[model samples]
Target: MTVYRIPAAYLHQIEQELDSDEKETMLFLCQDLVPDLPVPDVRKLLLALNAREMLTPVSLSELLYRMKRFDLLKKVLGIGRAAVEANLATCPQMVSKYRVLMTEINEDLDKDDLTSLVFLLMNDLGMSHVKMAKDKSFLSVITDLEKLDLVSPNRLDLLESCFLNIHRKDLAKKIQKYNWEAPVHPIGSSLKYVNTLQASFPKLSLADPPGIVNKGRLKNGACNFQTEQLRMAIPETGGALGQVSNKYRMQSQPLGVCLIIDCIGNDAGMVARTFKALRFEVRCHLFLNVDSMMRELYEVARLRQHKNYDCFVCVLVSRGDHQGIFCTDHIIPGFSLERLKSFFIGDRCPDLLGKPKLFFIQNYIEASNHQETPSLVEADGGLCTIPQVADILWSQSKVDASTLDRSPNSSSYYLTTLSELLMDPHKRTLPLLDILVELNHKVYEWNRTNPAEPHSLLLEHTLRKKLFLSGT
Candidate 1:
């Protein structure tokens, strides 16, 4: 009879004392441990043990010692000594197959393949199975495994959407990698910086234009010495201020910006130039009247989240005699200042204070006339008169507190009529320069036709003087 010799290490361990049952169990486990061994070799070992009929406790212990010496006991019977007993209690063959499968899968999976497999298992697998699978719980686990060395520009939108849905705040922190900070606006440029900021930071939210209560009144209130300087300045000032507010919002880096321009004949080219200089990217929502502008602002504010802006700039130009009422008790009754404060203060670094929030009012407010007269003396410079037309007009208005209480028809009827005329489509179609000219012509005709209000004559004189001096 030919005898096959096991390795010396196995032989040394097998020489020790072992029980018969232990020897049979150890031999079974050892066969399972040798994953890719020839079936013939396994059968030979089993047959040799059977032929001997030495499967006693001492023999089993000896075989177990041999398996242990070869460091195969753990692989064959799982981790602990009791694990082998547990395996035997269940379907032992099934447990053996599970061990083999785990080993093969571990060796076969690369990082990318593992990530894809995990994603497949998580997204495709049933809820019950996912709950049971320990490794498939976290979706980010796969992302961690597959992240590239260089930053992937193509993944920005994907990352933004994912982070937004996932509520991942850390995404904002990663903005530095893309250099997404606010840039400085160019000086002395006529471009609207607010619009530039809007274009650059698409994520920010901006206030809408101020609301206009009496669009007709705002348009044709009074061009004579009878309009409030503040009322006249309010529309243009509000626009400038609104731009500042938008700039602040964009600096905070929100999700989107909104712009509202409510003026009959706005200098769109000037506005475009100003915005370009400021590097603001803005999308404009234009409104011809105050009611529509205010309605939209209120709607946006009411529907949008608390920190979002609702009212931005309201551009109300008065070519005739009316003032635009941006915020009113009726439209947004009981609208809280606290809410407005939050709009500006919601961000960690608030950008709304102590800046150039107002601009270009002197052009509109100052009397347009300033010319050098003949010098009284050879050394003396020419004398010039600079009448503050805005102040004089505001002071001379006949609408007192009592008049304000009456209907719009009762208060300054001529101003009201002019407001109505400017609101007409035919009137609005004229260019701003042509409109000013036409307005002067109309005032001259009115002075000729009507004699009750001598203020019209004064207004005509002032306008003509300004036009002559400015050479417009």
Candidate 2:
């Protein structure tokens, strides 16, 4: 028997019929089912769902019926609203009740209603949230609320109350109805909510991709060696100490040395170009074993060539766990990040003293049951102590190892978004700390749209002043 496939032309026709708002709404409704997809791409989304066998002709008709696209249901699929209603008991609803309720609420909110809602919740939300609500769409804000656990299937009082305050009792009724109506479970449904139960974060896989590098051939690893490191030489403007009194002093030409250590070879070049464009001398090394990694890091920390530079930046991409990042050999317990930081400390590397040392770690955390051991700090009887971890900012993200396996050449969501934000000309003057906050916001948006693959940013810093990478 010949297998059925969704025609590209059919999908294109359906896509052409959808407006921007409809496309966005459809994407939100399908997020839990087919995630990590580009937004507002109706055709692509339908194709993906069809490819996954999660959407049959019957289910597709039901989806359009729920979206109230009855015209398309009849014209495209030859299914009438009556047939859809009759088969409602047999068809599994792909869109969750929680998401549908939120989307309905969003549809009822006009610009003034959204403005009033944000105004009413000003004290309740954070400073960043206020900015987000003002800058982003109302649907985006709803996604943020869901991420913060402020809204969920079992919770609607906050939303209903907000609607009431805005004089939208009709909108509030939708929420009340959702709560009052008891959900019916579709018995023996073939398309299970499998993705819902999947890990929120991508788990780092142990096996390396073929042709990238050989785990045993440490000596034969590939490296994108820079013969003459490109540096941007812009004259210093402000005082020797940056223009801002509280900001970190960044007046040096060739702002810093950015070392890109990519275990997976896909996104190194993209990352290298981003930092290099930001006026930093960039160098990249790939597929190094444990020994080679240590040697390269040691050389970077103690190198005299970077003595006059303003800061030190390292971007390490590899598979890691709670303990640390893995080498090409796929070791059980990888290299400790603390030990990596130790190499850049003032005690070990004086060349970087008083200068900001930033590390952007893209680690694919392995999925396992490994537990972290607690450490006890013992006093050495010293009356006073200075923190050795000062002037260093660590920005790390852990993704599932399966991400790489699914698309070997694809970059992780975190790194791809980070590079894009860093390359923005408008953000060049912004402090690195603020840029990171923006990165978190971008990731939040990504997770909101792509529920399948969620990337989290974990930032830890010991810097005493804001570090500006550009406009020095």
Candidate 3:
């Protein structure tokens, strides 16, 4: 007898209706069982569920119910809300209670709440992870924790402590509730308990139980290894859909200033022209040394010109090591990426406050043996105000240094592709997020064809709305 799975049309219909936040919420709830998913599309998520043999009609209904997507539940599953609740009451839930609790806590967290949480976890998560999480959702932070083996069903102590530190007593209570109702077993007993669960509910597919030897393998040959590193490489948007209201305001005449710092003096003209076509006033600074570059950035950040604009874009094309980008003097380590963005934060550039600050960094990395020694910048302890990194979109790409030896007229793959995409009349009307998704796909395709000199692009943002550069 063939087991029943959700129909492809039903998955397509459900995927169509989910907004960005709803898709992220579903991914959060499924993170434990289906951790480190590359993209947040509803269809791929459901397929993962099915692969684990957990995508039963009842489990799907429960997931939709948890998401409060009753319309999909009723329309696609032909299951009523009450019926789902009743079924959940009688049967075991495929998604773990811990994930559900985490999802609820995430839903309750606002921007300030997430900021406080990141600050609290700074020491534990380190500067790199903190920087990545600063502009992302709470679920992204939790996903990292899951990757590091820091959070689990039995590992609520650290999370609960963070919640309390953030002054979220109500969210803390949810964690406490999970701890109370969920069974606590010694690490050694996880396998036995998993076996017992399988025996009790054969269809129940739990994520790797804490302390299970295999870590992330299913009993039925399912490969659920959560590759967190590759998550950003793939496009998150998946594809376009009907227009939605959740986008950034980009209606200003001169959208904003496009400040291009081209160290090699080769790509600034092209990049400058691209943003200019999008209604931005372009400022190109070519071949600046460290001191001059810093001063120019400082002046740009304080310029009165920002007051007339709706957005700000900074393009940096240079050589770089792991710690920071190199200037004309490549022998010494130059400015850290964080330091570059610091000048335009709310405190320093109040005019650009609440406006989107977009940074596009394309750095060519020298061979490892010739790379500069990486050093910590903020090694000295000092009292300084930490900027809230909201309304900023950061896109960085690292390419092989050999690419720089190419024809001077030809720019780097990332900047060239970005300029082409922005200048494309067809894509100008699409939201920046959608264009980025396509860019990521194009880069992946390039990597597949030329494995020797591959490129990587990372998109991280705290923009609260969609960004359309249609020049309307």
Candidate 4:
């Protein structure tokens, strides 16, 4: 016993409406029918037929033949000549074999068939492949099919996959041409100034004096005597001059000493020796760790009085690796601007905006091969006989002797040990601050006489002006 499905009461209602001779109702029902629908209720009703028993092949064929004649199937399926041609090109079996065998009788397709085709292309094949196909005609067909709601959700993933496979260079060019959105955070303006400084002073070569060693002890324990020796030799060595004297006198009073040690490890000893040589009464702090140094600096600055030791003479003992200083600035645990200020300038000093506290860094003071003559001319308006003076000016100016005639009183000196020491791989020396102090004193004495000729009349006038200005 086989059970058969019926079209139900709605189909009967539809049939009665169609048989009333309503042309529009008949046309709509005729176009709505398909090969898949076995029973035609309206036709069966009009013929007084037992639709279930009339399942014979001939009967079904005649019914479909009449339906096709009204052009109802073609209008309902919306299968035009162009659509049929496109379907035939990609899928010949739909019309050539399946349609003929599946249908009870040959029939023209309605809009339903076209709608089904569109849905099939969209859900089954995926849109990305259709878009990528070499045939433009297929793409146009797909575009039309999409209007009927054919494409599926998985099409987006297929499109992304296609884009990812593009050549790297092509992708890069496309990216370059594209306008990029600005980043949220831009670099600070201070970095530009720092970069300019780095560009201007690409390489700064400094020198250290000879006979100064890293041996924890000086051969002679006599600090005053050693200081005198440094002082005495400075003039003869071209370290003394009027310009040098004026420069030192103009520098603001020191706040504190900044100890910058290099990789050589003996900078502590160097600092101790230099401080002793200069007769500066201050305790030297040795920092193996950056945190301790920062803490000490702050603590000392916090003290209300006696903040004269604010100048830091960073003695970089090692050669070539300057990055350590940057690392120290970043990692040092305790650093305060207040401490730096108190240390460099005493509490009595006015805070001048944008003035960097003076720092005198001394390193690599070995004698150099370069030599220059002093530009010191005699009071009689003739050049001095000191060959070292000439050598100094020569070394400093890098100009030929012809240029020396312009500034007669200009005395210059090249470090005696600088040329050779710079080439030497192994050797430790004194801090630059000590050398500068010694040089300053020597220049003061030299300028008191000879080319500078410190006049009593000028001194008296200067003293009078200072006293008058102070209202004393």
Q: Across residues 200-224, which tens digit of lDDT does each residue of candidate 3 receive?
A: 1111112233222322333432344
What local lDDT score does residue 395 receive in model 4, on the 0 to 100 scale? Answer: 11
Q: What C-alpha lDDT does candidate 2 achieve relative to the native structure?
A: 0.68
Q: Point out the worst 10-residue segment of candidate 1 by lDDT.
A: 357-366
Give lDDT per model, in order.
0.29, 0.68, 0.70, 0.27
Candidate 1 lDDT over 1-472, as tens digits, reads 3433333344334434334433433434444233334552434454444344323232333344334432344432224555444534441121122122222233334555544444344543445544554453222232232242111221222232233333342442342223233222211111111100111111211121232212111112121122222221221111353453212122222222233242323333344333333333333453333334433433333333323321122222222121212222122121221121122221211222221111111001112233222111111111111121211111111112232333322323333333344455565444323444454455445545643332221121111111110111
Candidate 1 deviant stretches above 4 angstroms: 1-260, 299-315, 318-472
Q: What TM-scores do the predictions have?
A: 0.18, 0.45, 0.45, 0.20
Question: Which run of 10 residues does model 2 get worst, by summed lDDT?
Answer: 195-204
Which of the predicted structures, 1 or 4, would earn the higher lDDT when compared with the native? 1
CA lDDT, candidate 4, residue 215: 13
Q: For model 2, give the RMSD to the true fold.
A: 23.0
Error of 2 at 191 (Å): 67
Number of the top lDDT candidate: 3
Question: lDDT ranking from best to worst?
Answer: 3, 2, 1, 4
